[model samples]
Target: MSTLELECPGCDQVLELDAGFAGGVCRCSNCGTLMTVPVEAGQTAEVVKQRQRPARPDRPMTPGEAEAAAKADEQVYTTTSGREVRVGKTSIPTAQQKKRLMVRTATAVGFISVLAGVLALAGMGVWMLSQAQREAGERTVIEAFEYSPGANPYDQRLANVLGLPLAERVVVVVDASASSEVWLDEVNAAIGAGLTETSSASEVVLVYTNGDGLHMHPSQPRAVARWRADQLIAFQQGVSTAGEGWLDEAVARGMQWLPRQMVLVVGREPSEGELVALERAFEADAAAKLDVVAVDFDSAALDDLTGTYGGRYVPMTREQLVRWRER
Candidate 1:
């Protein structure tokens, strides 16, 4: 048996056929096109027939093509196998695609939330550091007024005003007369502050004017001493307001101590006779200078007195003392 080769006219696909089946009709396997086989010069026109193989199921649509077809809605197309395939109307996101998209969206939201929390904490940390720095600065300013151990704000302030480091021979005369009853405690505290600046080798005397006369601690000049609380309490109790105070006598007694510096705590203005006596006492020993602390008392005469003796005059009010004590 001989065979003949022929090309399908519909799709240009070559096919081989038996000579006995010359002029037979056949379908192309490659493209599924049907055509009649041509006859050779010596072959008979047998009009033979051959059954066509069923066209392969239309080539399944590719992923990309299927998506396009679904979007196009009920689109139809001829496949390479010469069969028409109809795509049903289908949404872009199938159940599986929708699930994947939801997971991606949730992950993005969670990441954004975590990032926001981190930023908030960082901001809070910065704010706390700034607050700490601000408080430290405030503490520094408040500490500036304290200069010595166990020293209150009042003591430090008084020390600063008095120009501390007292002279070698110093005398502090406090007025314990009736006029000083209102501010006696403050006067005592002030004297204590003044004594803090005295050196161990320095001589100090404390004098006070009472109804009887003038009273002096130690009765003579001696090295500076820290008075005990009981001693101070006793001294405070001994003050008498029965008679007019001997302020002039007290001043003279302090001057007799021949101190290099004398501090007079006065609660009231001096009388004319007292002033004259003080002037006379100061003139007797011109070398002894005077500094006056006038408690709630403003006296130009005292100011002039301090000026003549080359000393400072400090005036303090009850309100200022109260405020200092509170601090």
Candidate 2:
């Protein structure tokens, strides 16, 4: 067989083939471009123009070129054995193409990682807010029930001035002056009814207004005593209405125990000097509260005084006291 040398028209690369391969299609070894071999030696090969080939000198075929080459019709040629052989285009990726694919994959993975981190941070913030709210709720419950030791649990009442539950430390100031003699029995009944509701845990002090000062039960300010119905009756039996009493002095003396709440039962309107003295006493103890239960009397000064201290001034009539005692 005669050897033939042909130059590929696509890449100008020289190819050596046998004369038996004349008029047959083959790919150039240097550029992988398909071309038709000539019949004689020294003839230039014609490029098989199945599709426009991309320009890539001294480099591997790009992915686009490889795909185009694969889609082209398969070339059939007769080998030296006289048997027909089929040749199909097969694409092999270049190193640059492999590197670009790896870069794309890494970018996708990095984006997913960042998204997961953001989600985790948002979840943690929600958890922290929930924890704070839970702690605040617990603190509210604890503060609502906080009371002094040995204090009556059943006698607990919400302070109108503080808008909070009162502690076990309580002082009841009764107006036992000559002006309150008419309603003194009703006041004692009301006080006894209230004290009957107290449990053994209660710590109470009864302060009655004397001629010009205040008289406290048990004589000692630091006496830890639980007053019941019997003790309230005994305290009232001992009290005798004589003359006009000093309201300011009685309230000031009630503050000596530093009671959390004080209930004042007054049958007469407070004087200007007494209101001023009451306001001063209230200012002295910011934590202490004064609630006035006015019996058969209502004064704007007394109302304003209780209002200034966040306390309630409730006026009660004879009929109302009767109904309360009956209840």
What's the number of clashes in each of the models?
A: 0, 5
- TM-score of candidate 2 to 2 decimals: 0.48
User: Once all C-alphas are superposed, what RMSD does model 2 give against the true structure?
Assistant: 18.5
Q: For model 1, how does the per-residue alpha-carbon lDDT over 1-327 read when each residue is reduced to its tens digit?
A: 344567666666456544444433455665666565455611633432222333333788778765554445433333233343343333111111112457788999999999999999999999999898756643433233433323443544322223233455778777777777778776565455554443244567778886777877756766544534456456656765545678788888887778888878788898999999989988999888888878898999999999999877878776666665665
Error of 2 at 137 (Å): 18
- Estimate every model's Cα lDDT from 0 to 1: 0.62, 0.62
Candidate 1's TM-score reads 0.48
C-alpha root-mean-square deviation, each candidate: 24.3, 18.5
Q: What is the lDDT of candidate 2?
A: 0.62
Candidate 1 residue spans exceeding 4 A from truth:
1-165, 193-199
Model 2: per-residue Cα lDDT over 61-112, one tens digit each: 7887666555554444454545444444442211110124587899999999
